[model samples]
Target: MNDFGSLLSQPVAQLGASIFTLGHVLAVTLIGLALVIAIPVMAMRRAARAQAQIAEEAASRARLAEERMAEIMRAQAEMQGRIGTIAEVFGSRQAELTKALSERLDGMTSRLGHSITEQTKSTHENLAKLQERLAVIDTAQNNIQSLAGQVVQLQHILSNKQTRGAFGQSRMEAIVADGLPHGAYEFQATLSNGNRPDCLVRMPNGAPDLVIDAKFPLESFNAIRAAAEEGGPEAQKIAAQAFRRDIEVHIKAIADKYLITGETQETAFMFVPSESIFAEIHENFEALVQRAHRARIVIVSPSLLMLSIQVIQAVLKDARMREQAHLIQGEVSRLMEDVGRLDERVRKLQGHFLQANRDIDLILTSSEKVTRRGAKIEALELGEPAPTAPESRATATDTAAHGRLRLHVVEDGE
Candidate 1:
């Protein structure tokens, strides 16, 4: 029995030791669980504080945003009111600008219409003027055609020698007739040598007549011109020589026929109808001109001949004036004598007028005396006393004196 009781005691001690170790394990586990719970609670409390701080900060930021939005809204309202006022002002200004532009456009439209009307009128006037000018141009063209025909006829005439001579003669005659009076010049007049010159201008005071010959050497001159234009130099030289010979021959013939010692002027004119031919001769043929001058043959162009005729006309007029000088002087003397006689007659008439004036004054005085006497006779009444003898005698004496004065005035008037 003792052994068994010892074994139970050993097991019971072992069980107690195991229970103690279990208690320590339990205590350590409780501490660990408390610590874990406390740590979680603390973490939860800190998260709550952080959430409240975040909420407060969010509310402050939202208030600030609200304040900014309110300010923005007020500014927007004010801007809208300003925009409305600006729109009203812009509308009024736009209306004024539109009205001004309309008035300006109307004025411009009226001006444009008036300008167009003026331009149309001016265009019509210009067209009329242009038409008139065109008509004038047509008339001028017709005239030019007629002149061309006349020029052709003249060329034909100049081609023939006889017709050319006649043309020159007619031209010379026309110049002479136009410059000198009728009866002063004679055409185809016969000289003392029985040769009929083209013209003879009569000189005053029995002077010798002046002679003019109109025939020219035109054929050779024309040949020279043609050869110069169309032929070689040799032909031109030959033509010039022939022309010179022809001119010399014509000059000699004219000088022989027209120059007479006592019948014609000492110098006779050989008229060249063409001034160009005269100028050519003078410019190129100095020797020929000298020879003609020595022969007393004056080569003259149409203008020179006209000038000579005018000089002759002046000389004739001067001679006529000289011839009438004595008659004019005699008439002047007679006029002076008539003037003297008229002056003497006027003096005698003045004397007669003065005598008549004196006689009229005496007549007026006698009339006045007679008028006073009649007044006195009328004033006497039928019942009045008669005049005294002395008054009657004085009145009769006054009447007799008045009658004597009246007779004296009448005799003086006669």
Candidate 2:
């Protein structure tokens, strides 16, 4: 230990006396080489690590991209399936809408055709009715023209006194014939006093027959009217006086001739064929009318005389009904007795029908029992208990009867 310490302190090595060995030199050289190699190796190793890291990162990114692509492909498949379903739905809907539209259009077209046909028919019917109405109106117009010509001819006939009297008599006869039955009235029949009346209505109940005279004082009334229209009071007054005198004389003549106490009615009718003349006499010569009434003469227009004839007919009808009252009552009583006999016979027949129905019910019950016994016997021969027989059905009957006779048939089933 002393020697080693003296050698390190000897400074064999004082300044310029430093000692060098092979081992020391080699040691220093190895150290330097080691430093140089280690530095480069370390740097290469760092670069390799960095490159490995980059490669790892790239691999991760590729995996993520593949995953995203798989996801996108799956989504595309799903979207395609959804789109196909939507298209199918839309197609079916479109077809349905088209068919519905077509059907609706057809129905509307049919309806339009029917409406047009009906409208055309209605229009034709209306046209036909209008034509018929026009024809009717034309016929009415022709009738009016014919009536005017007849009125002119009537005026010519009425210009003569004899023709006017005949016209009045004809009018009165027509009225009497239209209103009364045959033989109830007589035309131009001479009375016991030798006065021939225009018409005589025979009253019932032994009453005197009514007399109707046709002659009237129309000439004097026509003169008065003409004079008045000529515009002079004196002419009108003179004409009116003459008309009064003529009517009074005619009334007296009719009363004397026609009024037979036992043969004619108490009051006699003076028939005036013209209602206009009747109205004029009443309006302008009321005093003459009163005088005629006092003389048992009733002045009548055609319409008034027709009404009187109708009254006479009604009276005759009432008298005939009165005369037949007892016969009608006897017929009614006989009819009632016959109805009573029919009712008694109907009741007796109904009783017979009830007894027959009861007897039929008994016979049907006996037949059903017999059929059941036969079924039992058949089962006994077969050596087995009889199966239950089917239930009997209700009977049906059709019957027709008149008075005491009847026809009927009954049917039954199981």
Candidate 3:
């Protein structure tokens, strides 16, 4: 602090000097002028430096802006490329989806069309079958109606005793004719006891004939049925008793007329034409059945009579077959002998064929030897000069005969 004060006092003391030289004044003025000029020059230089710094800064800012713009433009270009790629991918996917949708639609259409066609065909076939079945049902309905009418007519015919008996006789005759051969059965045949039966079946092997009586007592049975339907219990009882008596009388009459010891079967069949009447007798008239059975009389319906005829026919057929069995056996024996002779001839023929095969094998061996000799002669003629010898000059036929002789000699050696 004292040194700074002394320096300021020196400048003040110099200024306060009384004696003033011209050189001192001139030096002071020059120094003041130099300071003034130097001050202005420094200020100008500083201003110029400031202006240059501002210009460099402005240039740097301009370059940075340009680089930022370039970067932005590059980014924009990359974005555009990515956007293009995305658009292309979207377009390709759309095309694939469209193609897949189209193929699916086509497949679905084909399947639906096929399914509809098959369903239509099946429906048509079902309709056709239904129509055929309806036609058949209609025909069956018509047949049933006709059968009902026939049953009504049959009932009317059987209502009368005479017609019912005639029906039974006719049915018995028809069955007899159908089941028995032409000469085997006789209708209304006369027996030795001066009694005429409805039908008689002759037996084979001198066996007794079978009598089938067609007359059946249906009057009392009809009365019983009518009384029961009328709700008259007493009348039903009386009619049932009369029916029993009528059945017994008819059974006894058949036994007396048909049961001949030397002529007819021990048991005779009494034919009941109506199936209902036959069922009634068996169901309600057990005592009568037992009595008839005791008398050696077999009661039969139309169906049973037919079955009995068939049985008789079968018996006759069996008897005839028994009579012919010996002839069949003799013929079969002769056929067997012929077969044995044929087998022996076949064996002889097979042996002859085997001998022929052996002979053919020997002929083949001889032919092979002849072929080999010819081949040797051919090779000698091709590769060597011919010898001037008589054997070599021999005719072709002589050479062939000589080869044959050599083949025969070879076979003899073997």
Q: Score candidate 3 by TM-score against the native.
A: 0.41
Per-candidate TM-scores read 0.44, 0.42, 0.41
Where is model 1 more than 4 Å wrong at Cα?
1-167, 321-330, 351-414
Question: Model 1, range 1-414, lDDT digits (tens) per residue?
Answer: 876555434422235446334445556789999999899999999988977776666556556555655664565566557655765675676567557656765765666566556555655655565565456556555644544454454344334444333347788887777666677889998777799999999999999999888888788889989998999999999998998998899889888888887888899899888878899999998988999999989999876776687678668756655554444555445545545554555555555456555655665565466456445645644332245645345445555655665565455445
Clashing pairs in 2: none
Root mean square deviation (Cα) for candidate 3:
39.3
Instruction: Point out the higher-scoring one by lDDT: 1 or 2.
Output: 1
Candidate 1 vs 2: which has more TM-score: 1
Question: In candidate 3, what are the lDDT values of residues 62-109, reduced to their tens digit?
Answer: 565556556645655665576557656756765675576567657656
What global local distance difference test value does model 3 have? 0.68
State residue 322's C-alpha deviation in candidate 1, in Å: 4.4
Taken over the whole model, the C-alpha lDDT of each candidate is 0.70, 0.67, 0.68
- RMSD to truth, every model: 52.9, 33.9, 39.3
How many collisions per candidate?
0, 0, 0
- By lDDT, rank the candidates, best first: 1, 3, 2
